[model samples]
Target: MNPWEVASPCTQRCVTRPTGNEQAYARTRRVPAASVLRRYASLTAALGSALAAGTRIADPSVLQRHARCVLGALGIGLDATGPLRVPGTAAGTLIVANHVSWLDVIAVLAVEPVPLIAKQEVSGWPVVGPLTRRTGNRFINRDAPRELPRFVGELAAHLRDGGSVMVFPQATTWCTAPGGPFRRAMFEAALRAAAPVRPAAIDYARDGTRSTAAAYVGGDSLAASLLRVAGTDGLAVRVRPCRTLWPHGHDRRSLAAAAHAAVSDAVSAPVLAPRTGVFRTARPPEATVPPQLRAHA
Candidate 1:
């Protein structure tokens, strides 16, 4: 916290500066806090070991509650609604959601019971990693090709234990409602784990104003983004339904298609509209939804 405090550029008083602009953010750092006493109070009630033993995590929802209040006080409305459940939860599930802001995971966690599948680097982050780990987040090396198999194995073990896992298949944040193709890694991992994949689309809405960019993600700096959150309006957790996925074995195209359909099912088509603000599509142009994923109810 000390390093964050520096003399304001034009004043003698110490203040922290926001580093890593949009461009610089693309080059580094991905990944907050609170009324400490309040958080502890809430965590004790929401995430007691007994609750975790029951295969449930209570931080995201609890945090969401507090965040909603704070955002509301600042005139930032967090308007969220339906498509709140996921399948495979009874036998260990894997949730894949559209990525917009870091809060995306929190929203899913609030609704679904699962441990987060985060980037391995997050485990070493100063304050972020500590909080994440304490909340049961698992990490993988986004840059490591060789470690893929090991990662898969660990996920399989976790699922076999009837534990749910949540992953960000996009690999990067996008404005909400992009409806982009899900990544192959996430698809493949779900397959290897033999767990059902729930494609959950998440977004934020306020005063009927929905913006995919509402959460600070993509080429945004951690400090800048956090400040933006600390300074802004309320955001809702618009949860789409969970489109259930079968075990993997399909090629990348098939897997992507399956994911798209699940996500699309959760949210209506043409998810991007002026009324919808902006959409971000960061994956390959050819990625699509597979028919098998949408064959049944």
Candidate 2:
């Protein structure tokens, strides 16, 4: 069975900165405890509102809209550059983006309530877990490489059915780069499903400069990341949508390379410095989602 041929449903689902323009972001050197506290309170309130609205309505756009409002209250601003260029009437579109912070997900959701393809672990995260479930995300277990083919096939089928799916092909987040390297696997899904691929570049800026405060890299705890983000002023998110790519006889490897280049060209290049801030945790070789979490054909 071709991994790209599996037609199964998914079991799980799963910012920037400032300046004056430059002076808009607070210039305070130190993060005050009170400010962080206030931000957390606002975030909590926004989250509660979203959760309540989610239970009452099944529309993803509504959930995303509510979440977007809360994120703005949390002090994150959004800016979109370039034309989105996606066909409004096209059967499901595939969006591929570079992952920077956990806020990247929220940024995209705020812009559009698109469902996502995320790791199984994300399905268990604190506030994010329930939100993703409510939004109907597809979660994959990274430990089981053997299942990738079947999973890709199912993903391809979903796309073929006019269902939109978003994926972070890098599979992990990086604080200082456009992306690590584009994995070719998901590109295969586009080929199989004949879906148009849209590469989006997402960046975080503070006080008119790129900021790493939102990066959930290395030993940084979630609380620490949140506090840092809340404390930063003029934190803005920039998203650039590149030209769309069609299969057009392109193979998966070529497709992946093209998408990677398109996204990289639109964003800042990765810094060459030691990325000690972003640690790569090793997973158990056999760790994978339990049977109950996966979708059956």
Candidate 3:
């Protein structure tokens, strides 16, 4: 059996599609067709402008500004809590989040722009591919299990060199909260580098209620998802950064469990069952304080 076969799996079965009535409701909230077109145009212009500037504006703040502009063009707003960038640490921090939509990458960038771990296919994508490469993001080939150890080692080296990286531990997109289990392989990088792990919870909402308009799940094409996001009004992404976890005296499995619990609690989502036998111990006692208590404290 392939070693990577033991990794947690997330398939099309885990995706939750909106019902017919929910689809109708989304349509009602959609902007005019022309508005969507304009939004796309604006997004293109923003990407083009950023590309034209080259590495001169490669600063994280500049990248963050560019991301915000892209979101604004799509009529989406961003609300983030906690420190987007951990301060005073020379060691790179591993930023982990639950995956929901393609927009998640941009949403996270808007708050804190950093190179991310993406699937290898993203490197071949039209504009996004070139942009990601230009910005120093790394990609992994999910089909090539043999290459995973090498990739994880390189990722650890990067972190040890003080280069931060963001990754979606869910490994794939889900339609809503309480998504798939957090894969443990990526956490191994954090453990190897002795880097701190920062867990963030991401979700979409509109009119103060959870919204699935931005979800990009099974069978959802990129073009269709983009159009859906552009057409939706009052769409906003919420990023809540949880307490940072240190690797001292903890194994990768415990670290993954603790991070998963932190993100799940932050989004008010129930914790999903872990893959059988993958987690030998319960979530570590160092798990983050519940968001509600943290808020009052």
Which regions in candidate 2 have their CA more than 4 angstroms from the true location?
A: 1-31, 55-58, 81-85, 88-90, 268-297
Tens-digit per-residue lDDT, 1-297, candidate 1: 221111212210101222323321111111123543343444344333323333222355554443343333323333233323333243366667777676666455444545688878788876456556766888877566677778777887787556777887766665445335666665565565555666666765543445433445434576655454443333344656554565646664687677777676655532332232111233212212344322233
**Which candidate do you rate higher for lDDT, 1 or 2?**
2
Model 2's lDDT to the true fold? Answer: 0.67
TM-score of 3: 0.82
Better of 2 and 3 by TM-score: 3
Tell me the TM-score of each prediction against the true structure: 0.62, 0.77, 0.82
**Candidate 2 residue-wise lDDT at 236:** 67
> Once model 1 is optimally superposed onto the true structure by TM-score, how far is the C-alpha of residue 206 displaced, in angstroms?
2.9
- Output the number of the lDDT-best candidate: 3
The models' CA-based lDDT, in order, is: 0.51, 0.67, 0.74
TM-score pick, better of 1 and 2: 2
Query: lDDT score, residue 138, model 3?
Result: 93
Score candidate 1 by TM-score against the native.
0.62
lDDT of 3 by residue, 164-228 (tens): 89999878777776477788998899888877888988987765557777888767788877877
